[model samples]
Target chain A: MSFDITAVVNIMGLAAVAVFAISGALDAARQKMDILGFMLIGTATGIGGGTLRDVLLGNVPVFWIREPVWILICLVASAVTYFIAPKLASRSRTLIWMDAVGLALFAVVGTEIALEFGTSSLIAICMGVMTATFGGIARDVLCGSNLTLMNEELYITTALAGSVVYLLLNSFNLPNSYDLIGGFLVAFILRALAIQFHLKLPNPHRKD
Target chain B: MSFDITAVVNIMGLAAVAVFAISGALDAARQKMDILGFMLIGTATGIGGGTLRDVLLGNVPVFWIREPVWILICLVASAVTYFIAPKLASRSRTLIWMDAVGLALFAVVGTEIALEFGTSSLIAICMGVMTATFGGIARDVLCGSNLTLMNEELYITTALAGSVVYLLLNSFNLPNSYDLIGGFLVAFILRALAIQFHLKLPNPHRKD
Candidate 1:
């Protein structure tokens, strides 16, 4: 039975966009932002990473501007979150898990795109990390919430590990499906463990 | 004597890139970030807005990626700022003025690019404002500093007004030089006045 890995990847990409938008909306609700603010942040968080990646890789018009379905997904997700967030007992928890899923998906997808664009593995890995993390970073910055980059959590590291694993699988001539699934699992599992156990990277030591 | 308007725009763009990089470095100095952090923030501040504009307008490879001189300029400017920022009597004041210059130049340049790309006047103006403001916003967010969007300052308004002025001048069929110079002056003067007088936009009133 031959399955279409491309279709699976596209669906996961949409899922990532939706979850990220939901996380952004939940954040906006917590920040007491207005409806427009919720939609703006949600859309930004959904597309910021991919937009950056596409720009850097010379992919014109960006994915969202060309398809716009991604934007509609974000808007709908944000509106839903805005209405449902108040009833949720653990909005923060939900946001984090949603972010984890988005991170995993973006890392793999971004790496794949970069590799296809003929970038070196290092640049591809970096692009993956950027794609995974930049949207959340933009969301936090826009909302004046806690910055993921400022935190000691294994956030970026998870994306980096996932991208590296994906590249390694590709090097082994694995099926595209195996590469995508392996990459996503590595990133998601690492992020989940980090959240569950409060695992963190070593903090920098600075002397004034 | 007639001048090369395109050359003038290019030169001004480079100047804006340098000033923004310096501002980013100053911000990093205040935050006590390391050298790499300074470079990262500086490069982002230098190119973030134009990158966003290019991506949205479907200008692939981005300006900086095409020329790379912009990145070189940012690195040099940031390094210089790192060495000299501490000796400055007032870093914040310097940062604001530098940002104002960048804002003015970028506002005009971005609008011109969008118009050339055949965008509507409204969309072009929005692109102008975004190109002028996004770099500084990225710098602020990365530094965990104050957000321009959250603040009541007339920052975005200055860009908007400048872009409108540019579009109006274009409609009059004036020389491109006049439009560019006129746009820059309006943005700079308005921002300068806002800074000098602490002018702000009306705050939104929200009731829980």
Candidate 2:
């Protein structure tokens, strides 16, 4: 946990939260929500997964509540997005790609954090997937999406794949840098490819 | 707490979870979601509030995860509803009233639990309102309701009022049974009256 290493991780984490918050804000705008709703969903999407992880692990007061800066960042980012979403619609696809980067970063970092908390690797992997996907899930749910019926994306799949890859790397006692890069690439690329090719998992509700 | 009292509380808690599960399943049926969706939302709504409560309080592993029977009950109740939802439509109003009962019970119990956990009175009260409303919120969100725009009746208002009353009684060093009964009556009566009269809070977003 050298200062420089921690600094890099922290910066990446902030970026992930910011992008997620912006996306959440965009979602709120699409739903024609009030400003308060925008900020609420933004904050929820940014910190929700980690919050759930910490809570399940008995780490109370929650990270955002304890450290006000994260909350501030999420709210600020969301407000900014609310103002910019209309102008960004045509370019929204670019934003989703950035979200993929955040998704990948969060999946690996979330798992590592859980593992550091002394949870079993299995739980850590679950944490990774949840941390990566739960924020969007919460946002979608709040936006009134019949989530089960709309379950046609590779969203969770990308997260699980990255988490498994990260864990596999860790099993060999590889350098932290290696696992970090390898896992991020796997997740980011997988998600990016999915989005670009309009990849979708089969929806059980849909008749073939 | 005495064993007999604890037993009473546990039974009440189980009933609350069961009714919430049934309501959640019914919501899924309304949306035509698959059986998997029904169980997912059912379990989520049933335990969501307690999970959120424990996380904020730093109590980990969550109540349902620790005592899995709660999850079992929620899933089983939901499964039953999946088969009976169509027939239950005419009787569904009765079920909503049952849900009101659960809401009242959870509001007081949630407050008491938070107080037992040594949270500040204000935080405990917030927990009570959340524990009562969040389950329904999750279900509505999963069922694709525009919640804020649909804010009506005495839903959260009753929970907040009852939690305040319960906490006030506790401040006087009243017996737990008395607080429980008083709070439940206050919440249930307020909610039932609202439903019977078709009362609604002003919809701020409504256009003239």
Candidate 3:
């Protein structure tokens, strides 16, 4: 079955934006932050990765500036999450899966954008990894957790795999639909497996 | 007294590196992070701004890569701060002042580097401001503080003033000594005054 690559990307981008925004809001709520703090984290988590991606690619006006819809989406998402957090707290596991999905989608889309901008495959993969992780990094910082760089989770590894798959598919001149589907499936499945199995990279100096 | 701009800049650059590295180490200790985290934050805070400036100017290898001394300085500073953090924490005010001095020094050094790289005057000022504040942004993120973008302190403003002074002096064909001393003094004094006077820009969007 044929898939619409552009449609898939656009939907994925929007979904990723919403999931990250919600995650940011959840963090702010947990921290007992004010409304402004909630809004800031939400907007940052929603757009930080894309903004960094655009800046590094020398894309003028940035993504959110070109389309105000991104900010509006974040604002709405933050507000909804802020108000409904009590009920949503029970579904933390669901949000974690959604976040994994968003991470996979963003990894593929970010790599594609970098490739379109004529970056080398290696640089494209780095950009994809940055795009998938930067928002969470920003969120963790705002939340006062040094875990952004210290967390031994398999988060960035998933992004690396997805980006590598995209590059390999493009190298063989594979159909764009197949590349997107395969890349997304690989990242999502890998991330889910990692979480379900409590997979983590070993810290060389981890103290018992 | 005639100032030697080159000598002054070199001195300030070293001081900036030391203070930034120290602050980074202190932050790592505050978070109870491991030694690697201390080193990462120290190196990042020491070179984050300048590295970004070089990248924006299309300069290869970056400044720190070109001069290994800066890396050594950062490493030593981090190690020293890590060992002395307990005593230093008792004197937080002094550390804050030292950090302010580093901020001023970095602003001037960054401005000069931008000019040397042939960037436009405006871009030079932007780069200088970035040099002064980007380290703090990186530090704040690593320390898990949301204050990076929201802090209304006179941080960037001080850098801007220093850069403008440097550019104006250079445009007047003043000796390099005059440019360096005048620029550094202006930024340093202004920042000190701002802190002493509790000066801040008026928030335009005060809640009614």
Candidate 4:
């Protein structure tokens, strides 16, 4: 019951890239940034995590370096968002839900890539969490906001949950589709519920 | 003529950490940030480049993980700057000079580290530029300014010059101290001269 990890990774990567690009455009729109700013944010969000991963892996000709389509996608996404954002401004809730989907997909894909490179489970999980959250962190920083690092958010936790689930399923030689679906479902559900219920982890520095 | 790359690297790293911490503190003082903000900015500036390098290298425990002193140094530096900054506020030129020193030191150190890790010469030069500039980029993002990346200053060019010089010296099997001194001198001299002459690179998009 071996899985073709590469194919699944590619699909997940493309999905994550598109979702993050849109998210970046939305963030820029919220900040009232100019068109160039929006495009920059979108490109950064789309390629930032993959670039980090490739650099760590010592993979030359980083992802976007080889395939320029990712840049085109982000540019188009930013342009489209700029013109259509007014109509979609009221759909922040929907965008949040889609972002959860993207987060889950990216976490699993990142973990798989790390595992493919022979990283330990702990390192894989770290990679997964990094891949899932770094784009958002970059967007927040660029937009002049303190990242979720200082806050009690379930962001990394959700990614960790997906990573763990994916690892466990793969350990038992589960079907590839099952592993992907199962991992994404767990993360997406947890994230959606957390946002819906306003669930947040208790800050360690806060008085109980 | 063999060289002790490790020793030179260590000195450059320490110098980078110190100068960047000071720069961060000065920036925080300019913004009148609170103590926590000062410490955060200082520590980020001090360790941010190394952290990025480590993440890219897939190095475990990152640079600051083993060294608690770096954090202490940044904290102390921030405290010192907070108290002394008001008196030094009139000397903005001095602060800028210190930042240039930090940039030179970081560029040399980062290039050496990347070369030691077996990266190509081009990659090493990129690393040097990243190491020298990333801290300021992070600071600017946090401070809600776009001046760092958008400016046509000699910042990145100086770092690139230092890195290329270091690589060439190493290729010639020169002494480690010679390369270090040479690299730092090149960067510092170029940067200082640029500032003194008010020289700037032509913006690619600017009309003549």
Q: For residue A168, what is the lDDT in candidate 2?
A: 90
Model 3, which residues run further than 4 Å from truth?
A34-37, B1-47, B51-109, B116-133, B144-208
Report residue B144 deviation for candidate 2 (angstroms).
5.7
Q: For model 4, what is the error of residue A10's alpha carbon versus the real structure, in angstroms, after optimal superposition?
A: 6.2
lDDT tens string, model 2, B85-127? 7777789788888888888989999999899999999999999
Residue-wise lDDT of candidate 3 within A72-112, one digit each (tens)? 89888988888888888899899889889888988888898
The residue-by-residue lDDT of candidate 4 on A104-152, one tens digit each, is: 9888877887888899989888888888888778777776767754453
Q: Between 3 and 4, whose DockQ is larger?
A: 3
Error of 2 at B61 (Å): 7.5
Quick one: best TM-score, which candidate? Answer: 3
The order of the candidates by DockQ, greatest first, is 2, 1, 3, 4
DockQ for candidate 2, C-alpha atoms: 0.23
Q: Of the candidates numbered 2 and 4, which has the greater lDDT value?
A: 2
- In Å, residue B35's CA in model 3 sits off its true spot by 12
What's the lDDT for candidate 3?
A: 0.78
Residue A58, model 4, lDDT: 67
Runs of candidate 4 exceeding 4 Å displacement: A1-47, A50-108, A114-133, A136-140, A143-208, B1-16, B64-69, B147-149, B205-208
> A70-103, model 1: which lDDT tens digit per residue?
9999999888787787765365677678678888
Using DockQ, give the best candidate's number.
2
Cα shift from native, residue A175, model 2 (Å): 8.3
- Residue ranges of candidate 2 with Cα displaced over 4 Å: A1-98, A118-130, A137-152, A157-208, B1-3, B25-44, B51-94, B117-127, B138-208
| Cα RMSDs, all models | 7.2, 6.8, 8.2, 8.1
